[model samples]
Structures are given as C-alpha cells and as structure tokens.
Target: MWEVRLAKHLKADLGTDTFDLVQVPTPEPAAGEVLVRTDYLGLSVAYLEMLRADSRLPIPPWEVGQRIGGGAVGTVVRSNSAELAVGDLVRTMAGWCEYSTGPADQYPGLDPDLFPSPVHYLSQGPTAYYGMSEVAKAGAGDVVFVSGAAGGVGSLAGQIATCRGAAKVIGSAGSQAKIDYLVDELGFDAAFDYHDGPVLDHLRELAPEGITVFFDNVGGEQFDAAVEAAAPGARFALCGALATQIGDHEDRFPEPDLTAAAAKGIAVLPFSTYHTPEQVAAWTEHFSTWLSEDRFVFPHTIVEGGLSAAPQALVSLLKGSFKGNVSVRVAS
Candidate 1:
C-alpha cells in the first residue's frame, strides 16, 4: 500500500515536499475488519492548519511520520464482516493511502449511484450547510453575504443561503473570474473581487442596504468589513479564515474584530462542523434533493494522477489554484 505521511512537523513553509508518499505492506483485514482501496481523497483548508507546528484548531495535530488522514471514498476490496461486502463503495477517514484496514463499521457503505460521480461526494458540504442553514439561518428577506465565496465551503455556503430563500446573495472572491463564477454559475445576486478595492468599500457598494446574514469564509479584513456592513442584529456564521490559514500568510492567525460587532448587536457565531453522521445525512439529503430539483449547483474540481498527486493537489488548493470542492482521484 502506498500512503503519504508527514515528513516532519511543519514549520514556516508548506509545499509538496512537506509530505512523503511511500509504499508499505498492505494490511490484512481481521475477523471483523474490512480492507478498502482508496479511490478519491477530499482536500480542504482544514488540513493546512493541521499541518502547522502549533495549530489552534480543536482537532488534534498530526505527528511526524503519521499517515495524513482525511475524507475519502473507496471500494471494499476485502471484507471479513457483514457490515460491508466486496466491491461495495464506502466513505472513510482513511485518506492519502492506497489501501486501508479497519473495523467494518468505520468505512460506511455508500451507494455509488447516489452522486453524479464519486467526486461529488468529496465535499466540505457538511460545514457549508451547517453554517448557512443552521448557524446563519438564512431565509427570505435576508440579504446574505459570503466571503471567499469561490472556495469549497464558501461556494456551497452562498448557494445554500440562496436555496434557503435569502432575498439576495452576494459573494466576495479573489479575482474577476471567481466573481463571475459566483454570480453567473452559482446564482449569487452580486459578486465582487476584494482585490479591486477596499473590502469595506466593496461590501458597502454591493450590499448598500446592509447585509442581514454574513456567511464568512475569509476572516481578517472581510470579517471587519462584514461587521461594518452588517445590519443591526445580523447573523455572522463564521466558517473559515482562508486568508490566514495558508502557510505563507503573514499573521496567519490574526484575531478578527469582535468588539465592534458587540457594539452593533450583530451576532458573531463561530462554529465547526465535525462531519458527524447526522451532518453527513442532512447535507447529502438536501444536496441530492436540491440537485434533482435543479435549484442547486455542485461546483467541484477533481485532480487526476491518483495518490501520488494528492500532495500537490492540497498545496494548490491552499494557494487558491482551484475552485469549489477539491478532490484527488486516487484510483480508477
């Protein structure tokens, strides 16, 4: 089995060199275990923070030489339990590896026919849906704004806000192409490139009346700007800090302004999606239904070259080289 592992605890820099993809003896399934071959690996910004030497995320940090764990979908090639059968598709936390061995229950069976492609299931949708629908509670009459709206969770968060009936959905991105993608492809009411001018100025112009729901993905300036542009009592569903999550970012963990939000009575709620079974179920149910209803767009990008390409794919993801949900096809 081939797997990528942390070469060392990350310090000031992160790149493809940070990982080592090596071959190991494939593990055999125990009496109650199953052996699965990796097919697709989901990449998210969460992994960037996890790689750092001092990570603030609630999740534990990875140790040197540890297997890089993440979301993955694969086929059960060998099974010793009744929970799953050979050739059945499943979602697992056994990412970055060509093969995995675990209890049958850990790799839950998934119907391959559910999504248009296995790639579709590799998403940050649980977080996106949780923030927009639950935390922000976006709905009709709400003027919703999403920061870093071209990335995985942001892309879906903006669209989820729209589906939940936000009267207007506005998004902020890094470039004109991403702005166009948000508005034209994802159905945002308006989209702006933060690089065009002051983020505050962009927000004030696009959401002049004041935004009632702020689905924030990029923190720092965008959070400050959103606080300034928010209507009284607006809900801020704090999701990601893409601006600082990058390894090379200066002030990679800058504190977002909360005092001003308090003075303005805007609800600043920061939450994390643990991707529990309930969360996965809620998102997949809504996602499938929304796609069937033709009211939602599943924006995604799949990187080829299997497991060996996974490291570079993750590096590119953090550098904003791709859009929407990102995944690596680890196998055919």
Candidate 2:
C-alpha cells in the first residue's frame, strides 16, 4: 500500500479553526470501483456552512484525518468498471486529496471523449449543468433573478435563463465590480449589491412589475426578499441557502413570508442538485451542450496548495473573501 495521504479534516468545533492536515495510507479501489489521481477539489459556500455545522448535513463525522472538501476533478488511474477507463479525466465528489478510491458509479457525466482542458470540465461542468436544468427550470418569457450571480452556478444559471427566453434577467452579488460584470458582461438586465441597503428595497425599485421566476442562491434575507417581491403566479426555485446558515447558525434560516406568496399564488420549490441521479444526468446533458458552445461561464477562485490549504480556503469562500466557485488544486 502506498502511504502519504494528506487530507483536511473538520474537527469537533465544526469551525475551520479546528481543521487538521495529516497523512495516511492510500488504498486501492475494490471491484466496480476506480482509483483516481485528483487534480482539483471544488468548494462551495453551502459545503463550508455544512462543515461549520456538521449536524446540518446528512454526512457522518469527519474521521480523525479524513478529507473534508468535496467535488473534485481527477484522472482515473485504475478502473474495475467498464464505465470508466484508466487515464480518463473525470469529476467526482471525492474531496481534498491527491488520490481517491470510489465506485465508478459515484461520479457521472464525465465526457467519454477527453476535453482539450480537463480542469474546466472538472470544476464547472457538473455545477453549471445541475443549476440550469434542475435548479432554474429555465424557459422563455420568464423573469429570473439569480443571486450570487457571478458564481459558477449563478453565471451558468443566468445564461441558461437567457437561452430559454427569459424576458428579464436580474442578479445580486457582493460587490459593485460583480454587479457591473453581471449586467455589462453576463447579459443581466439589472444587477445590484446585496449589502446596498435592503435587497427588497432595491429589487422593488428595479422590478416594479415583480419577478416571475426567482432562482435563489443566497438564502436568508435574500430568500425572504424573493418571497416578498414575487409576482403573482411566480415560480420560485430554491437551490441554495448560502447566506442564512453557517456552522451552528442553521436555526437562523429566515422565515419566509408565505402569506405574501399565497396572496400572489406563488409556488416555492426547494431542491438539492444531488437529490437524484436522474436529475444529475439531465443537468449534465444541458451543461455539456452549453459549455461546448461557450454559452456558459464558470467563475472560480483557485486556492493554491493541497489539503493543507483547504481549511483557510473554505473559510475565505464562506466569508465571501473570494468570488465565484472556490476550488483547491490538490494535484498537478
């Protein structure tokens, strides 16, 4: 067995402050499994929150020195399943590691034909694909508002909405820089800062007619604002709650004003991208096509180093120190 598995671990306090980087023995994939050489590990605001609040997610305790990050891109070094081949570049849920072993079925949507650049496929492919098809339900004539608009998912979601014929696309971000980029570059009708006073107030001014479709990436106050500003007969897609809960702060999930939604006949549908395998496949198809055409962009923040840097990187991502999808380069 090869040794030296440096991994990031989330400890008892559930804060990045307690994270540890340690070494272990590498293991081989069993039957039906594949061993991969990790290249990049994707981080999410939601995942960082879950790391801070271990009780909030459905995952188990972080083993003494097990990896804590998830969503990675890697090359298959060994494969026991026909679905994957050695040297195949793929994306998987395996976290901050140089190498990992898991069932081939655990990862999906890896293009059988290798891409010109494997890193792009690993970081943005699944996230963009998942958000457009499942989270947004993008279609023509819909008015869509995407929060965290410059993010990996939000950027793709915005483009997908436009392609589907949305009448107007509005987005919210953390900075004026992002706001300008969303409108001038990403085709949003209007973009505003989340901290520019109250979101509801700004949204009301921009969308006097109200939004017909709201794709929520930042929950908490933003979610509340969506509920209040929804047009009659609106379709609300609740994809992520990045703002409300962090670590033990999950109980702070903003109470939605359902009364207003009911009065307007609005429909709220909250879902996770990982809710089903079929959903993942559906997203992958949409993403692959859009990505090939350069219609979607996946904004990312690459935190250098490997597992040793995961804790700080995750903390920075959760604190909004960096914009877009956050990832750590674990190998190569």
Candidate 3:
C-alpha cells in the first residue's frame, strides 16, 4: 500500500517536496475499528494552516512523519463491526493516505451502508448541514448572505440557506463564473463577484432592505462588509476566515462597531464544526435528509492524483485556485 504522510511541519511551501510517499505493508482492521481503502479525501483550509510551522496546533516530534489528518470518503476493505460491511462506503476523519484505520465508535452517526460506492454525500455535505442548521439557523423566507460563496463550505452554506427557505440568498464569490453558477444553478437569490468593487456597496444594492442572516466563511474584508450591511437583528454566523488566514498571515478581528450592530441588535458568533460527535450526528441527519430529498446541491473541486497529490491540493485550495471543496481522487 502507498501512503503520503507529512515529513514535518512545512514552512516554505507544501507542494510535492513536503511529504513522504512510500509503499508500506497494509494494516488490517483492529478490534472495533475499520480499514478503509480511501477513494476521496477532502482538502480543508484548517489542515492547510496546520501544515505551517507557526500553526496554533503544535505537532509532536515523534509524529513528524505521520499522515495528514482530515476527512475521507472510501470503501470498507475490512471491518470488525456488524454495522459496517466489506463494501460499505463511508466518510471518516481519516487522512490523506490511500488507506486509513479508525475506531467505529467515533463515527456512530454516519450510515455505514453508504460507503465503498460513491454516494452523493462527501466532505461538503456535513459542513453545509451543520453550519446552516446549527449556527446560521437559516429558515425559509429569510434573506441571507454568505461570504466566500464559491469555496467548499461557503458554497454548501449558500445552498443550505436556500433549501431552508431563505426568501433571498446572496453569495459573494471571487470570480464571475462562480457568481453565475450560484445564480443559475444553486438557486441563489443574488450573487456578486467580490473583486468587482466594494462588497458593502454591492450587497446594499442587492439587499437594499436588509439581510436577515449572514453566514460568513471568509473573514477580513468580507467580515467588515457583512457587519456594515447586516440587517437589524441579524444572525451572523462566523464559520471561518479563509481570506484572512492566508500563508503564515494573521489578522485580528476588528472591534465590533457596536453602534452599527446595535442598530440591528445583530448577533455575531463564531462556531467550529468540531463541537461534538453528537452534534455532528444530529446536524448530519438534517443535511442528509435535505441531500437525500434533492433539496440541496454542492459542487466538488476534484483533482485526481492519488495520495501523492494531497500536499499540492491543500496548497491550491488555500490559495483559492480550486473553486469548491477540494477532493483528492484516490480511486474510482
């Protein structure tokens, strides 16, 4: 079996040279665990930042050559639990390697039957589900705005808001094509190219009345603009700061213009999807229902190259080269 594991926390760059891809004897499933032959791995911004030397997460020296951690969708080549079968395709927080092993106890909520065969569900599904269902609390007839609207979580956030009955869902993307896709396919009420000009100006024009909710994925300028354009009493869900956390860069959140937010009595709160497995399970059910019912849709940015390409894909995703959830195709 081939595995692409991190050599160490990288500082200069994370392209081909940063990892160690080696052929190793495949390990079998341990008791209460499952061994998956990974087909797709999600490249997340959090992991990208963690790959940096000054990362908030300190890496253990002994584990310096370990596999990069995140989520993957794959087929169960071997399983010890009756809940999972040999061909079951499932999603798990495994790694960027071609195969992964983890305890089944941690992922009790996901349907084991959905694995090995590619279902509509993947990395973006749960994120869209949890962010909107829990943090954003978006509902039908509400007007919503999502920053970084073309990225993985942002794209799904927009769609989930739409599915929940938002009267108008506005999305801000980096490119015109992404904007078009949002409006034409994803059912956004309005879409804007953030590069065009001031985000606040564009948002005000689109949402002249006000916005009921703001699901923000990118921080920095977008956060500032969302604060400025937020409708009175708006629910501001702070999910990520992709724009601000670029390449060894960091920025502080500006002091809330209390006067501005006070005008609307808006609520600005930050949340992480890693709250609890119980929460993930509940949120997954909600989003999965929407997905199973065809009420929501997501776009995946897939780069096929197996595990060796994992490092570059992570860099491209963080640099905004990929338009949606970055996935590494390991097989099929």
Candidate 2 global Cα RMSD:
3.6
lDDT string for model 2 (1-332, tens) is 22122133433333455565556677788999999887777766665444432435456544544456467777898999998988887777767667788888776546656344455554443544465555556677777888888776787677778877888889999999888888877778898999889999988988888888888877778877877787888887776776656434435465566787788898887765553556555655665676688775556677787656777776676666775667777774
The candidates, ranked best first by TM-score, are: 1, 3, 2
Q: Kindly list the per-residue Cα lDDT of model 3 for residues 1-332, writing each as its tens digit.
A: 88777787666545767677888878787888888888887777767556665664334322467776776778888889877778876776667677777786544334654332243445565666677878778997788999888888888888888777889999998888888988887778899998999999998999987888888888777777887887778888887776655444443234445566667688887776663567656656666677677776657777887777777787788777876677888875
Candidate 3's displacement at residue 321, Å, is: 2.9
- The alpha-carbon RMSD values of the candidates against the true structure, listed in the order shown, are 1.5, 3.6, 3.3
lDDT of 1 by residue, 1-332 (tens): 79999997777657888999899999999999999999899999889888876887898888889999898999999999988999999999976899999999898889799889887788899999988888889998999999989999999998898888889999988888898898889999999888888988988888889999998888888899999999999999988787776454356777776898999899989999999899999999999999999999999999999899989998888888998999998887
Single out the weakest 10-residue window by summed lDDT for candidate 2: 1-10
Q: In terms of lDDT, which candidate is stronger, 2 or 3? A: 3
lDDT agreement with native, every candidate: 0.89, 0.69, 0.73
lDDT of 1 at 272: 92
- Pull out the clashing pairs in model 2: 52-247, 53-247
Q: Estimate each model's TM-score.
A: 0.97, 0.83, 0.85
Highest-TM-score candidate: 1
lDDT of 1: 0.89
Candidate 1 wrong stretches, greater than 4 Å: 246-250
List where candidate 3 sits over 4 angstroms from the true fold. 12-14, 29-34, 56-63, 79-84, 102-119, 247-259
